[model samples]
Target: MEATQQGADVFFVLMGAILVFAMHAGFAFLEVGTVRHKNQVNALVKIIVDFAISTLAYFFVGYSVAYGVDFLVSAAVLDGSAEGSPFAKQGFDLVKFFFLLTFAAAIPAIISGGIAERAKFWSQAMATAVIVGLIYPFYEGIVWGGNFGLQDWLSESYGAAFNDFAGSIVVHAVGGWIALGAVVLLGQRKGRYTSDGRVVGVPPSSIPWLALGSWLLCVGWFGFNVMSAQSVEGVSGLVAMNSLLAMVGGILVALIVGKNDPGFIHNGALAGLVAVCAGSNVMHPIGSLLVGGAAGAIFVIFFNLCQNRWRIDDVLGVWPLHGLCGLWGGIACGIFGQEALGGLGGVAFMSQLIGSLAGAAYALAGGFAVYGALKLLVGIRLTPEEEAQGADLSIHKIGANPESEMAPR
Candidate 1:
């Protein structure tokens, strides 16, 4: 029975890992559909390459920083068969690493959307290494890994440890806020705004592709939320239901608030998912719906403000979709997870508020520190000529539809 259960847990986490890993494709396609035709290829390439780099960084350093576990031992020891091994039997630990690595890789995937069309490829790649290896994991360790006793402190003072069932703040918020720094540093995409500050619209390259990406993410998020339990016995059907309701709520609200804009509609679904991630396990389905609705509204409002009013030029509106909505999710977990609100309870509003804010601040500072140093030392933006050429051709030397651009055969 022991061996059987161990194998089952390993398989469960491995499947979850595979599902979350597939969301990287969702990330890629979403960016591809959002950016102009001239930069679509770069969108696809950056997500995959960043995932690769994230894996290396996390495997070598980030994981240890977060969890204090290292894979420096032999394969046999890592498999947990060796005597005195701390790892779980049947290689469950290995699969758990794979699962968590998907979450870690999402930081760059989230940032990729915000900085699209204008960031220097190599500089952003280096940024990915530093973020996944150090900046992200430091906070991840404090909250999830209990590295700095912040969780204990929160629990003692506020009556619960900061609860992020699926990384609303840790992954989405941090990635979003960090992207803010990058976008600010890189400045507006050339021609995105006139000298007089009038907004110039950059329409999406493909709506179908954007919708497909949203669909993929919606499907995979079941695993991202449910499998966060990490064990079959720990899984809850409520999580699945909450995720569905939240997604529906987001779509409906976005459709209404965005006035049927397909881009807003597709991205609204993402905002809801991002917000509900923290409380999916504990909130009533109805509460989850409200949370999702709020997130959709937040995304639409802030996205417009960031782009048009503020002239930030965050290409995909990532800071709004992920950052602000994610912070809301973290705080919402405290509210909607309370028994007074028809939730499972054991969460504190104060703790959630502080923890979420801390994560955002840390990520923002780290973003400026990393991207700022890179800007000073090596530059993080493309030259004006390169920006005008677009990243697909400027960085990759090819367009997404190369054959279409070809002369007569």
Candidate 2:
């Protein structure tokens, strides 16, 4: 029986790993579509760099902090295993590791989106190291890492805890906050805003890429959401069915609001997935659909507001789609996600509000502290000359045409 249980754990780990691994293709396509063609190569390079840096960092130290060197403690939480057991035996299942890696990889995609077109590639690369290597893992330990640290305290004290099943707060919000900080430090992209502060439109060269990216993300989102439960036992076939329903809800909302606009429809699919991520393992099928539809509607309204009102240059719509919708998911979990799914009995809606604010604040503060320091020391933004020259050519020295300094503005 013991041997059988161990085998099951291994199977879970491998399956989750495969699911998370598939997310990379999603990230690649999504990011590729978001950036202008002038900077397409640059976008691809950043994702590659993020993956490399996150993997090494997670293996060397992050794995310890998150899974814990006191591997027994985490293991005990999982299966009543002894504390201080063999590191190899107690660590995150291969599936969990793969899932976490995908989470780590997702962070830099958000960063790349915010800083697209004008960022110095080296600066972006350096930021990627800081985020995955240090920032994310530390917080991840507190949130999802076993042994129940801060998040557990909040969960118990408030209601069910700071319940983020798939990381509306853990991954998406962290990425969004870092993206926010990077943008603040890097400043707006050239031609994004006029001297008088009017916003300008920079149409993408290929909507096809964006569409492809969105579709891939929709598929990978299954892994991103369902894998959070950590087992087929915790996440059953019903949960998977709910996820499908949620996607349908999001699509329906997008169609109504988008009213024949293909771009909005594509983006709506991603918005739905991000919206459902927080409570995919917990919410009812109907609940999931409502949450997803709300996210799609919110994405359209709020994103336009961010563009027109705030003039924040989030090139890939990360702020509204991921940041705002991820927050919605957190709060949704508090309401619709029940104790059985991971919530506290009689979960107070207010507790969810507190968690959402707290997560956002933590992310914002960390991002400001880290990226702000980097900006002051090394200078985060590129020179005007470099901005005019496409980042691919200016920073990387490779582009579609070596002689072409910049992609046409």
Q: How well does each candidate superpose onto the true structure, as a TM-score?
A: 0.99, 0.87
lDDT of 2 by residue, 89-188 (tens): 4334544666677787788776777778777666666777777777888777777774456656666777556666778878887787777777776677
lDDT per residue (tens digit) for residues 52-99 in model 1: 999999999999999999999988789999999888888999999999
Residue 157 error, candidate 2, Å = 2.8
Over 4 Å off, model 2: 1-5, 70-85, 88-95, 146-148, 338-347, 400-409
lDDT of each: 0.94, 0.72
Among all candidates shown, the one with the greatest TM-score: 1
**What's the C-alpha lDDT at position 40 in model 2?**
77
